[model samples]
Target: MKQGARGSAEAGDRSPVAAVRVPAQPRAVDVDRERGIVSGAVRGEHTHSEQPLPRPRSAVQRSSVRGQILDALRTALVTGELRPGEVYSGPGLGERFGVSATPVREAMQQLALEGAVEVVPNRGFRVVERGTRELAELAEVRALIEVPVMLRLARSVPAERWAELWPLAEATVRAAASGCRATYAESDRAFHRALLALAGNEQLVQIAEDLHRRAQWPLVGRAAGRGRGRGELVADAAEHMALLEALIARDVDVVRVLVGEHFAGAV
Candidate 1:
């Protein structure tokens, strides 16, 4: 007999019948337990075993968040929430605003490009410190660019075109009367931008805006400290309306004088 036949005969003789063995299939619970161990080890304490990880925000969502951060930061700068010469971390600002640090960082980078803040390596950003001399320099550059173009616009653009900007001018006056510095600053910017837009040169308008923003940074925390009253801002708004009226009247000489006086008094 063959060796397998001999072994089967011996088993049958000893036990009266042969017994067969089969392997057991893995259970669902055991499989799940193994997977849980792997996932928990990989994710550590920051993840749940049953829940999935969150996906990153989409590009559009990120862009919208960044824009919101930028606007909020601008408001903070204008309203003196972010003081000049003070250093701020992106994470800290994000925490305060209940957002992630990414948008705050992007916004700060934009503000840095606009000369509103300086980036510090290994740290964050410091608001640019402005002195009277620097403000004067900024005013001079603004005047040099704005005065000539405005005077030209006064002579060239039709009175009807100038009339279209009346709403923006009126808005500035109203904002000033409300005595809200942030609102007034924004309205003031709108008035200038609208005035510059009459020239129809986008580059010129952008440059003027940059200079205007730089000029405003220094006033962040100094309004109350310097005893500068809302009356001063109201007077400035009145002057803007007067300038618009002069432009509509095609009074180049008056516009020139007003532009000079405006820059002179800006500081």
Candidate 2:
């Protein structure tokens, strides 16, 4: 019996049902001996790994032309190149940007929705004229809405979170130093947006941004040497960094005062 048990003993003793083996998956073919093809290895010389993400065909065709025109138009409005009450035609603006009028019209329709412009019967679109009083009132409303929210966030949001915002605040400073009102306008709003977003309220951020955009657009003569100076912008940007520091330190009093001082010059 013992001699019989020793004859190819282990293999003979094991049951087929008790044998262990790897789970099955479709095997990848090895194109060469270099061996990156067993599992989870990328293959495709034609569609290289470095390729950018694909976009929808419509987005690929239309977003660049229309999106850029919209941004340029808004920049013109912010910098006073597009004066209040002045009318512009899609074809005319399209000629300026060297594209077809369809995209320009599309962009202007979006601007109209934002309340930045109004459509004329057939003349085209006109910049919505806002008086100085309206501009100041918008500033007041922004401060009234944002200041309390910011204060609350300062108390609850961690210092680490505020620290993450240093780069955004610094972006505003760089924009301020550029001495271009349009550039600073965009960066300033970006900073405010990052701050307000921490409140976790989508509606609040949307309302605040609409007011900010309206306030950013130059009133009547604001860009005609009457707008805020480059030095003032630098000072304002400094206040942003300072307020961020105060928030990081959880100094509510300082945050309140800095926010007040900041909005005082917003219009």
Candidate 3:
């Protein structure tokens, strides 16, 4: 959920780009827009044999393919798969994606615009890392943007809509109780998405979605596999319930305080 220094990224012996080798199964993607990095993969749902084993494939499959590749790439970058100062080439990535250079080039260009990749003269792209201070700033920006949005949604959203959210919150709790990190993580995200659904602001939702993706960068699925204790998980669930109650009551002060506390604890 946090970004680290480029020097920290450099310390690892493994080539940053090597981690981009996709597992056989689908995994999470974490993208840090503020730091221009991304990483993470799903965990706890698969054994080693079930990892997303990579294979050659065509980019012509569908728009989703490009989107998936972008997601995968973002996950890698955020998770340090493509670490800072690491060299990357479009053609090399095309080979990895089983596509021609065109799509890879296009994708890389898009990432560059997003500030995730830097084009070096006569070289390919390099994953740039942020300083600790920069990472902190990123977190601050997220807090500023998300806390208010959640509070506003809390005040305006109605009770019946909360029924839709309860199931997702329950799912997160169930996943946490079962020690299924990936499932828990997905459910956890779904719960928040459910809350945001009431906002009816497409641009805000998109922004929040991007921020959530960045938050995933720090630990990948590790958070799910080794989540908070059961009591803590229940407490978290209860907080959501409290939010719903406040929404049902149209208690703006209570909702704002609850959201602030929840995010302070969670983030």
Q: Across residues 84-105, which tens digit of lDDT does each residue of candidate 3 receive? A: 6655654445435544334455
TM-score of each: 0.73, 0.74, 0.58
lDDT of 1 by residue, 116-157 (tens): 899875456787766677877899999999988988888899
TM accuracy, model 1? 0.73
Q: After superposition, how far is residue 152 of candidate 1 from its true place, in Å?
A: 0.8
Among all candidates shown, the one with the greatest TM-score? 2
lDDT of 3 at 155: 61
Evaluation by lDDT, superior candidate among 1 and 2: 2
- Scored by lDDT, model 3 comes in at 0.55
Candidates in order have lDDT scores of: 0.68, 0.71, 0.55
Which RMSD does model 3 reach against the true structure?
11.8
Candidate 2, residues 167-248: lDDT per residue as tens digits?
Answer: 9899999999999888899999999999999999999999999899888887775534557789999999999999999999
Candidate 3, superposed: residue stretches over 4 Å from native:
1-64, 170-190, 218-254, 265-267
User: On TM-score, who's better, 1 or 2?
Assistant: 2
Query: Model 1: C-alpha RMSD to truth?
Result: 22.7
